[model samples]
Target: MMFKDWLKNKTTQLFFVLWLHISLLNLFFVNKRGIVFLWQNNSELNTLLTHFVTALTATLFYIAIIKIRLRLAEKKLTLGNNVFVFGSAVMLALIGFFLF
Candidate 1:
């Protein structure tokens, strides 16, 4: 396939996987951590906002790394996309654990 087509497919797949991860995370973890957005005190709002921001930031970071990996692979650079994906996931998990 062409380079542009390959890149588009990779990006779409990455986004789908990322969405699945985020959905599962919210379903299993967010409620347990009391991150629901409800009319409550300032502290609750702050906590909810913090969790939301962290998830957003982590997703963005993952996308950036994936884009870089795609570009490098297109250029025939010696880098493994799986390695970056796994590393990013581990780092994000650690950050989430620490935050919560």
Candidate 2:
């Protein structure tokens, strides 16, 4: 696919946004420098491990959101339904935040 068309895709946009969100969360909250610190320190193993964990975490979150979105899309749209989905996403994110 062309880059422009790829960027226009909902799935692509969602993935990009979620990846950026998780990355920022790690940078400011979880790691406080994160990959930069590892790079500066030249800790190859730590850097690779960090990258793997970040990508894994992002993928897990993406899957969770996508599954929830798909399930919700099957039902009639309603404010309550929207709220439930939002709440579920927040709860899942919190679980990841605390667990990690």
Candidate 3:
């Protein structure tokens, strides 16, 4: 199915929310441990690579969430979009700093 057409489906929209929520929860816990471990241990390229992979996943999930929400409603902006984006980004940023 085409991307925009798929987003029009309510089930697909729900899936986006589910993916976003699950990703966020996983990120919260995973990043908590990962960040702590990175800080306590000597930083290595492999370890940093793992964090980058996670960050990439979380970012993609967030983007999907935003795109689905906007496209489903056929609007430009919606309430609370900034809140979701900012909150997730901040959490990721915290994890990112420790990764490097």
Model 1, span 1-96: residue lDDT tens: 698898667666665665556454544324566766433442365655655565667567767877887898899988578986998899899989
TM-score of each: 0.42, 0.41, 0.35
Screening candidate 1 with a backbone cut-off below 3 angstroms (N, C-alpha, C), the clashing residue pairs are: none
Sorted by TM-score, highest first, which candidate order results?
1, 2, 3
1 or 3: which has the higher TM-score? 1
> What TM-score should be assigned to candidate 1?
0.42
For 1-100, candidate 3 gives per-residue lDDT tens digits of 7876764565455545655554444343355446422243324556545555655566667668777877968966565878879978998998899899
- Candidate lDDT scores, in order, read 0.66, 0.62, 0.60
**By lDDT: ranked, best first:** 1, 2, 3
Q: In terms of lDDT, which candidate is strongest?
A: 1
Q: Judged by TM-score relative to the true structure, which candidate is superior, 2 or 3?
A: 2
Q: Tell how far residue 69 is off in model 1, in angstroms.
A: 0.9
Task: Return the clash pairs for model 3, or none.
Answer: none
